[model samples]
Target: MRLFFPLLLSILIFSCTTKQKDHFEADIIIYGGTSAGITAAVQAKKMGKSVIVVSPDRHLGGLSSGGLGFTDTGNKAVIGGLAREFYHRLYLHYEQDSAWKWQKREEYGNKGQGTPAIDGENRTMWIFEPHAAERVFEDFVKENQLEIHRNEWLDREGGVVKENGEITSFRTLSGKIYRGKVFIDATYEGDLMAAAGVSYHVGREGNSMYDETWNGVQVGVYQHRHYFRDSISAYKIPGDPSSGLLPEISPNPPGKNGDGDKLLQAYNFRMALSRNPDNRVPFAKPANYDPARYELLARVYAAGWNQTFEKYDPIPNLKTDTNNHGPFSTDYIGKNYDYPEASYERRTEIINEHEDYQKGLMYFLSNDPQVPEDVRKEMANYGLAKDEFTDNDNWPHQIYVREARRMIGAYVMTEHDVLGAKAVPQPVGMGSYSLDSHNTQRFVTPGGFVQNEGDIGVHPKQPYSISYGTLVPKKEECSNLLVPVCVSSSHTAFGSIRMEPVFMILGQSAAAAASLAIDEGIAVQDLDYEKLRKVLLEEKQVLEN
Candidate 1:
């Protein structure tokens, strides 16, 4: 009788635990808190499907809420559906008088990238503050009642459990397991896609691989103002090889133009600075500040380069969306080659290093006596926005992950799509931005002068359609996974497609396809494109216009 009672107790405990484990089943599982992830969750809810957002980040909206307030929306007419809706919501928020806190509406000039700040006819605002963008994303979560488990880091090594090429369940670092029918990898790094054994590509592809003009290593292509205008010695002491190269300068020579290499473009913090004295916080020097680290920048200034504040793109309320401008600025070139596949600890170290480099650059520009006087005066006028990103000492919580592990899915969007040389089958979204790639490496020329390489900016013919095939993995690899942010595209093509608004559009389309796949009991790749297109158009997604 004692053994019988104990056995019954054990059975009951097992059943209860099983029931608890099955509690989190959802129709769609979004694996990031990026803007794309939030949009996916919202779309899934609209389609009457249960959705959960399992994010590794503490905050939502990735770079959108991070410091990228000046939206890189090229040909905004191509933006439609939830992406346009988001901008409209921003327009509504800015319409209210209360939104203008530090600066008044008329006082702050209404200007944007060759357009008005507010597009009245389109009912959207292209520019905004970071906090306002975060609020809109938070509103989506609240209104949809999304189940988001923030700070839930995935167990990349042994977290995913698959059955017949389908992700049955995934366990987090905290030992919590989540099961879902369809999974969307909306992260910039494509972590879930990699975990699910999806095929992906990193770094630039050779131009010959895709018959692309700008796909590979560009050694002499100086398309932007971010390069040295004159010959600058790479050494700490001018014209001396024994003086050692300055910090961040690669000793290796840049490869042949249009050749392939594994180097990645530079990364920088898109800082939000306030010119308003009432709401400005002085840029604090990073904990590991080293003045000697910026000798290269000092040399650039000494060589008569003075366009430092050219990229302080303005946003609302007298705040500027500061980006990398000159030859030696915010970008930590050639320092993040392993970030796409690095361990968590390694990635954190890289992030901290980037933060230190940028902070040190700001300190050097604003306070150092070596900087040009006019440039120093202009930089001193700006400081971190006090009301922005209040959690991380007024700095952005998410780093700008420009391009990471791009899924090599069923169909890759190459330069032919951007140039209208090839027809895009099963259109999901559109991208119109230029093929813009920042410098990947700073190498010494054969003439013994420092120069930047891999910066290319080629504008597309027009707004081009992004294929649905670019979002799904190969059928043999993972049948149920969808990757929106890290879609299948070459490095140069991805530069055009890797914008926040386009990501939101792709996220909505991915959710729509996921819902259809669940309803039809088919794999994500096998879902009918005609049915998906009908639903997307019905939802006001502009596919062909």
Candidate 2:
């Protein structure tokens, strides 16, 4: 009892010491370190605002650094400002011979759709490597001498201290108060905006809400060019019912399209892998890796689905940025529905599940007997690349929060914007990608077979303008906050606008709005677009055609 008392006292003292050490402050506090957050902070600094990026992530670049190295740039012509500059810097980095340390320059080539690199001779854009992208963000901060508070979470309830419609400052969870003239909620989740009394929505809006086809729960849409290799067969692996459904197959009914509710998109680590023995850290079995979890993958193999090893596109240094492959590959569907607005404790559970599932999936594919011999061999050839993200055992720290709490701002972008009906007058940027929503729910069909839905892929007829009003809250609501990551748009429209390039574009535009608000000493909602457009144009931000 005496020894226990002393230990408890020591723990209490250590807790006090730890609590004392975690306080910090900044002038302009940006609440995320995503590609968007980085661009926002860089733009703020460029505008001569005393800025400090308070990132929830330990790593600087969000998806760009996390595993989405394969840049999801839709229209390269539309990408400009610091967003374009980022890819340009990546092009410059790869131009050097030293950049090709592991593989020949010609051998290690880009496969995703994009324009060629610009050499100041021609107008070109859209090319990148993950590490190069992160380095460019780091360089921007270092060059500008900006301050960043990493791993700081915003106070969930009373973080934003707003007075008479203007945010005076915000406090962090650790009691660090950041008093600033203006605050930009650049986070993917929009925590700052939510705390600042700004309105937002989670999950998909009902189709009736927007009079749109793709806004709500799409239960029966199968639009992507994936799935079974041969014919869509009934659930019968040569006489096997007691064997049960595959490991990843969900047994829930895909809710009717247009119904609308929260559903999980598939999440996987965009593995940065290397063939070079030194650089590659083999995808070892995770601590809780269970072969049974990958039982469905084996079922997929038996059903003649063998297109798993197709996503490991090689980057420089013999490294590959591994992405989600085939129908039942990396996407752990039905497992992350509660992750978006979950508490830290709940989020930890979701993250752990994703890690365990992904790691188990890899282990099963590489070693399980049920897996095809060729498939296992091909998967075995790759492992978690060493030398990349050494801190987390090469695992990506950021879970791909595909869609989250979206702000329903003044002018909500809808199918009208993508279909070119209602032209957005206050164009801050443009998006041309197809309205692509990944599979939302998987199910067991009436025919006693597994199926999935909510994977809509309709290419827009033309590039659509994303309105500035979409980024700002309504004039009546909180007027100072700007939501760049999750802007006001219907789920269908958001599908096209939710690319990384678009996020960076919006980030720059949001920062410009914040700066304009400060310059004019007016609410962000009341800032004149004439002046905003002029500044955005000067900054090489493609506000319009």
Candidate 3:
């Protein structure tokens, strides 16, 4: 009977050894085509590692090419490695006369908008147009000859194949399999990290959870010009309680200050607009357009709020990277709470709803009689750029998913790290931006007035080192996976680290460690810090100030 059991065990082991090996294999597999994903792939190739990018979105750069040309670059000096190279390439592209199609380079250069587009001394342009940014990402792929598959959604249901705590392979919705020695979850959603059973948090953590003063729901903390300056009614009719709440105002009681909640901050499309009449697409009314949806906006305008063009930041040519400004502007608050964990189908529905809402808001601003004549006239001057985003009817393909699922990794960065109060061991990058978060919810105040809550911007005293531990999963959880975009950090710290430039920095650092791990045949978490730090410094990554 013992000999019979031994024979059965031998047959089971034999079956496992003969499993199929014919699949798309690489030294490293990246799951998203975000700016971080592209940069990670570039660094992997530079390290002579075979890499593949499995992207859900067709486009390469996420928000970098998706109308956020007015970059949130805090201190440009800290941006090094491939992240700085990207901006330098943009400068090279703009040096050519043909790059400026709508406006002359000379005229655009002297605008003195936010940051100079043509930095002659450093040869790096901080601001650029949407197409210009996309062109640079495409150039990187062509220059590196990296393999990329687009529109390939991960099969979240049993797609991640892990054997004895280490992921061996993963399948996409197309039934294609990808095998790699290491993987990077560079998506804003952190889909791959969650699929591998890694611990993560979606909503804001309680301030007490991390001893952070800026982590949780903030009600009266108004930092930007986005709060209501004048008291406005929250009812459909001026002062009627039974008339019910306005369209976007939430009725639920906002949680206590410094307390945690499952709600996420709002999201919006950073519209790439143009004042050039020859290269503009006028705002069109969307299907099922509702003017009543923007009744709050009209009330704000009636209360003498006319700062619609405050954040229409100028990019190259006559285009502007328009962002959310003033109370009840482009941010569609309290509508995307389920986005972090939503299924593919449900996420699409939420994105479509945001598109419709933004489209309707633009149409109302340009055509509605409720908007003041002066405000409407100024809004009409700017329209969607005709030459940009030509594939999706000139609308941006990527929505600004400001914050999403953050992994609880080997190290969790908090406000202490960002404020330089805590030591950052094994540094990989730097983030200098303020801890900024948009309004999470629009609610009726107890004073019977409409107000927006949850916008806070607290700057760090100086640039701080971002630890390498934030990019890696716990040793016992998933050893081979590295998360750069949705890194391990407290909500307060992530607000500063969530910038695109910082993502590229971490992505390159993640790839460097991945390549070293592959060379030593060790897990990413098990790699020695000195060895990885040596490679990063050699690649010109600024570790500390």
Regions more than 4 Å wrong, model 3: 1-22, 109-115
Steric overlap count per candidate:
0, 8, 0
Model 1 lDDT per residue over 1-545, tens place:
99999999999999999879745778899999999999999999999999999999988999998999999999888888889989999999999999998888888787777678788887899899999999999999999999998998888998998999999989888888889999999999999999989999989988998888997888777788888888898888888888888878999878878888888888888999999998899877878888888988888888888788888988999999999987888889999899999999999999988988888888888889899888888877899999998889887788888888999999999989977888899998899999989999998887678989888899887889999999999999999999999999999889999999999999999999999999999999999999999999987887853
Model 1 bad stretches (over 4 Å) = 1-23
Clashes of 1: 0
Per-residue lDDT of model 2, residues 127-240, tens digit only: 445666778889988998878888788888777788888788887877877777667777777788877877888777889988898777765566774443433323435235
Best by TM-score: 1
Measured against the true structure, the TM-scores of the candidates, in listed sequence, are 0.97, 0.91, 0.95
What Cα-based lDDT does every candidate model obtain? 0.90, 0.76, 0.91
lDDT string for model 3 (160-194, tens) is 99987788899999878999999999999999999
What TM-score does candidate 1 reach?
0.97
Ranked candidates (lDDT, high to low): 3, 1, 2
